[model samples]
Target: MTAAEGHGAMTAAVGSGATTVVEGRIAGTASSARVTVRGGRIHRIERLTGDAAAVIVPGLVDAQINGYEGHDVNDEHVDGGTIRRMAAALWARGVTTFLPTVITAEEERIVGSLRAVRDARALHPVLGHAVHGAHVEGPHLSAGDGARGAHDPARMRPADVAEFHRWRQAAGGIVRIVTVAPEVAGAVEYIRQVSLECLVALGHSSANAAEALAGADAGARLSTHLGNGVARTLPRHPNLVWEQLADPRLSAGFIADGHHLDAAAFGAMVRAKGVDRSLLVSDAVALASAGRPPGDYRTPVGGEVTLHEGRRLTLRGSELLAGAVKTLDECLSWAVAAAGIPLADAVRMASENPAALLGLTTRGRLQSGAAADLTVYDDEPSIGRTPANVTIVAGTCVHRGPSDAGLAELGEIPEELR
Candidate 1:
């Protein structure tokens, strides 16, 4: 069962014209307050007497996601059910908005996945609100080794505007972002045209500095998982990473799960791009979650993959990493713990930066005018204390802890999980 269904019924009735009050400490602070929600927007926030009850912040947004927990969006048989479950699972974490990424696949298969996401949104209110759109990540990428990453080399093809139109139509015009290889034939022209329809991003490229800049000039505005999609070795003077970092036009997405990028590199790159131009994306797959045993697993997209020690996932027999196995919530904690980034900056990368890049002004912020989408933790996230987090969407309480227990689990009594 999806987390929504597994949690029984929602605590707040939808469209009931009711006001909901949430008591919490503003996340990253020690102050306590009560937030009032009405008509799906935060009505007011007033200080409350007593210690801070919970840790609250704007709902997290993920730009690139493949799957999470046991639900695989790119599985061969993915459908509306898969999208629904994926949304439910992510909501159980702190992610309130995300782009369900459909990676390198055949034309028909890709269309099918897009249609499924579109249909799921139409059929379910919670799922629809949580999903922003589809992030089409491939079929137009570098075919060379190392750069290709987990995508099949044979499936990599030149960018084609016509194919993108077809995918967009299949997704009911909800295709928000598309990733392209800057060096591929017709890439510049393809980016110019497709970007008019949706945001075009650069990734999986075996291109030099000039071509990368050319792609940006062609209206490519984001770099997909900047550090991980290119060759491991590069010339010291000029490379795609340096060019993308130096250019201010492109906002970059990062898989900050500690496996796709090391702490030092992640810190340096974030510093270069600044928190406003940098976003944290899971780039996660089916096996993604907090903890899973080390073993061999089969997936339709990656074929044979292995979950190694320390939550690292890789191709069964290769040194190249496969995909991220952590959620945006976990990645936020990781950034603060390992990268030396401030907690507020890391949260902005996970929420505000991505929402602004996508033009979603109503989300990714905590204020009276913002939408009532929030994530609440029982306590601050640190090495010793991991507290339970609860998700609130449009004044509705969706997911609590594992057993889905009492309101006291929100930290008045004790810290549970964060």
Candidate 2:
């Protein structure tokens, strides 16, 4: 069935209502529960028959997303319509909230992208509701080789409060996150200033332990994709990785897709950061599941890249990774299977932890008074093995898998998704 048809079918099944009832085993709890949703908020949760096998968890919240389904957040030409399409696609994957991350680029492009996202949110309710805020990942990062990732070195610059003000203004004051290299000149002061308005993260850095601690003291609370953006080799001790992991003041985000970190490394990170302090970030790019044929393609910043195994995208002819291609749902699955983390903890890392990081109180929970954004899976161990059978955002059933035949009949695929 086409995506549009699927969406319509799901919508018809879950008509607009003052209240709705959903029955399933709640994540992080042992027994099944009947959750009542009213006015887009969870009104009540009551224990039900424990035999029900379906798993219900809060919808995933992604802290960092560059692009998806052919829409690049940093693209100068990106528009509101494109952002809306991306929102719909993300809904189908059980992501109810996310940040549209803009990486290092020219000043004009950054402002334009922020404005485009702001306009998209205003014009499309779906995009607006799903987009938590804007994440400025660069134009303030280390210029070293591996530390820079796919960002253009020519565009790299020191943190500037004036530029940040312009970006926040363009984004309609919804810019919630900024990533900077702590060792950069005036970075501590920058973090101190931005921390009042948004969360600050440290990334793409060659900072020493002292510098890392200093940034944390300055209100830089997160380590963006901690283990991924750094020199290939590091000093055995007193390295940036160890520094961030050892610091309890900083929570760390990781790209849990299999390619970003091996099983051993993933386990180690989860151990160091502990479940509560770790966050899962997609860090996906525009070509994610774009259905482009498996072959080499030149990206605007990542140089020549290859799409392999139908999922992995990498810089061509090198062991160096390019960017992530999986969604947060896929990453969650991998986290449970590969990292040996409990399913409940994995869900918290994806939802609750990030919500707390962003200071969003109404989201990332399935309790009373919380927003009724939930994902229902078919069975146990739903992490990597099961897809979301139903995804509801704010008490609205926005997506249902093809298995739900009771919904309206399928229709043609949406042009945007195609």
RMSD for each model, in Å, please? 6.6, 5.4
What tens-digit string does per-residue lDDT give for candidate 2 at 215-280?
999999999999987877778888889999999999999999888888789889988889889989
Candidate 2 stretches greater than 4 Å from native: 1-16, 290-293, 300-303, 381-387, 406-418
**Which of the numbered candidates is closest to the native, going by highest lDDT?**
1
Inter-residue clash pairs, candidate 2: 5-411
lDDT (C-alpha, whole model) for all candidates: 0.80, 0.79
Residue 37 CA error for candidate 1 (Å)?
1.1
Query: How many residue pairs of model 2 clash at the backbone?
Result: 1
Assess the local accuracy of residue 325 in candidate 2 as a C-alpha lDDT between 0 and 100. Answer: 81
Off-target runs (Cα >4 Å) in candidate 1 are: 1-17, 382-388, 402-418
